[model samples]
Target: MNQTVVSYLAQYEFFDSLLALFGGNQGLLTFVIFMIFCLAIVGMCATIGGLGTYAERKISADIQARIGPNRVGPYGILQFLADGVKMMTKEDVMPFSADKFLFYLAPMLALVGVFATLAVLPFSTGFTLSDMNVGIFYLIAISSLVGVSVFLGGYASNSKWSMLGGMRGASQIISYEIPVTISILAITLLAGGMGFGTISAHQRGLPTNWFIFHNPFSFIAFFVYFVGALAETNRAPFDLPEAESELVSGYHTEYTGMRFGFFALAEYIEVFVVCGVGAALFLGGSNLPVDLSFDIIPLQLVEVVIFMTKALLLYYVVIWIRWTFPRLRVDQLMSICWKYLTPIAIFNLVGCAIWVVLFNGKSVAQLLMGGGH
Candidate 1:
């Protein structure tokens, strides 16, 4: 599997031809190419964000035994377009009492943070925008910007409920990140690297080979990561920051029209990004259930479909959870993170290290089936 995928990427003739134009200035050429890739990713994220809202509404409607959206296009597929038009046409209102600069800057900052994580994602073999060595660490760092933006959005709003929501969101995201980072490190320890492509590349060619089944500790880490990610992204059961019952509209209470749309877009994009990260780290990312030699279509196309299917499955689950679970109280949310999830995540990280040493890097499935390849 490695030889097939890695070899193709290494000898990518198109990329090689592009590199030839740079001659001695390969670094600049790489930077230029990366920027172009980032632009594409931004567009992709925005499109996904719009589609995600439609999916959310439809799924929630089904769960609640309703029709969801059926007005615009077939089965309301064009509802997102209608929503976008509404947002753009609606009044762009800013309270006279609010700080104009921070109010405007907050949504942009949040949007940047979530979308930037896409840069390091390995969409498929040889299809990463920029596979940085410290990719996982880079994702953690960039995502913290969400907290900053939330806080600024709240404080700049000049509304007490907005301020409280912002503060809570900041605290919740920062606290959950501790467990999130540790859980990710558990996978990194197993993969023996921080690059996402490197980590995903280590997954073997079967469902049993996925890291989620690597060991009991890695298994626990998967759930821990899932829970922490829910909190980090302000999903239900941990959505205290935007608790409509208590905080009006939460951090973006004073925002309207396009500014509010930005916040919504960022939130939805973060949902997919977190789920995608979960897929890459725990599932056999972009790997098929059975290894198939590419004959008709390119291997990268097949791999991308597999990867997105896994990611979107998780994304669907997130939506399901949102409609099923009730939001937790702020105190309960904090207690869950600090008193339970963080400690358990730490233990899983340690246990994974010990398991790796004892098993000599073999996954549980490998041990159960026979010995390592």
Candidate 2:
């Protein structure tokens, strides 16, 4: 197995040498490092969620032909900070009829499920937190937990609207996962592995080499995956769970203060996670179109920036979509997932497999162009 970034750094004597200066035991040092990494992930996710809110609002305002946050701090960059403080200082109210335990448990569960999938995210060639062999499979399994959390949050709220919203969320997410998995499987077949790193490494640096443009089937599969992902994240068009016009804030209806914030944060963070995975699988993740060998800055950092840029572009699309599209009814959401996306995804998967067998892993673009580039 290839060494992960952390393991690579440790064995190269960087971590050991640094820790030795602190006179810490190996186990202590390991634990401390692990904790720091965990903190970093949490901090990163929370920070993204914070800034993402501002970005989304600004984007929405721009789409509607209005100026966005310009008061909080130059161009309202600090608006999210003010929003965070407001949410923090707000009352943490709970409905008397709510199931206290489950109510409290829901947000944590939602956050945990979303964050846990970060393990398999290959930020760059060697920068993943955990590069498991079953990386994609693990991601599918863990992400399903978000549905359960949504359901619990709604059910525990003891409100009719909340319960209905939770039910919709659970059904929507669970149904969507089917297409998402099959769509990803299309890429897995082409890559011949499930690891995020492996899949990314299979692609070349050029846009033509990206999986979305690899073949007809893969191209179709990318749309299928993208649709499934939007539903999975409870984004617009598929956002019946929190359809304010109907459900009055959905599953987290009764939640207040940080509890409500957790749900919101988890939702936004999941948006990035899905976008990251999409970039890794379909875009030439972290791969520059042309190589630049710079001695001062590592290639890994460059790759990370490239990968994030792709993901961020996708993330911007998600926000754009939320503001542009109207929410689909529950029936429409189900029909699209079960009748359209799932079958298309399955066919795409099978078609991709056949393409791989016939083309011997060469992309259509590569095969047509006589490939030596």
Candidate 3:
């Protein structure tokens, strides 16, 4: 185990330090640190996701010129928490027609998979819980769970509407996966030569140095990734699976009380995950985009702000698009994947190959300018 992991585990309790010695207690300190890290992350992500929910309602309300949840608590800030408490108190109900086993299991799977994806996100340069060698791969794998969990929830519900939702969700998400992975590959091609750590290091100063601005290829990749991510997360317009008039709440149609709340919460969490991943890949993750003598704001604070602002901006866009656009017909949705995103991502990858081989690790503009002299 890495020394950092060891150190983090040791933070849990001095007594547990002995557990590391038996090859079982590698480092009590590191394990303890990670435990705290996990708790803090889960709590903060939930709260932030909750805040996003509140903001979405408020924003949606304003777009329609209506009051949204204002009476609950000071600008409706308390509404999410109130909803949580109410949900926790509500009875977990299963339709008599549903599969008793899977119905109960589905929501738990969704909640766990969505929340766990946050563990690897780097809020600051060194603030991440686990900087696994496979950070990017881990993100892709864990995030994909959202698609599966939706299938489980919808399939388990035993309603024709729920089954339709599950089937649609699975199809849409699975179709979108190609573009998402391909766009990710574009980023991987541009920067995966550097590990997540090295990539973050590369982005240490000046925003333009960020991969998103590194070249034209990267610029296009971001848009491709964003669109594919929308499909993956089932956001509006791309959200044919849960089309209200069509599917009546989609997969969770038969769920009630806390079970349904868990599903609802998972949707927002997926949005946050997409935003954070985008921030990390194209928006400098936690790096400041400017040249700095001393990083006027410490890297930790800068990382948190840069990453969060990017995430929140992306989150807001998801909301904006949901309200601004109409839902696509199933054929339109599939057409988007096959015709638009896929071709663009593929062409962009070829552009990246040309750019990389010719530039020889130099910035596009610098190479064009012959600025080296």
**Per-residue lDDT tens digits of candidate 2, residues 183-287?**
999999998888877887778567989999999999999889999999999999789999999999999888999899899999999999999999999988877
Superior candidate under TM-score, 2 versus 3: 2
Please identify model 2 stretches exceeding 4 Å from their true place.
Answer: 11-16, 19-26, 291-297, 371-373
lDDT of 3 by residue, 157-198 (tens): 889989999989988988898888887777777775424565
Each candidate's clash count? 0, 0, 24
State TM-scores per candidate.
0.92, 0.94, 0.90
Worst 10 residues of 1 by lDDT: 1-10
Report the poorest 10 consecutive residues by lDDT, candidate 3: 1-10
- How well does candidate 2 match the true structure in TM-score terms? 0.94
Better of 1 and 3 by lDDT: 1
Estimate, for each residue in 107-164, the C-alpha lDDT of model 1 and write its tens digit. Answer: 9999989988887777775667767788888999999999999999999999999999
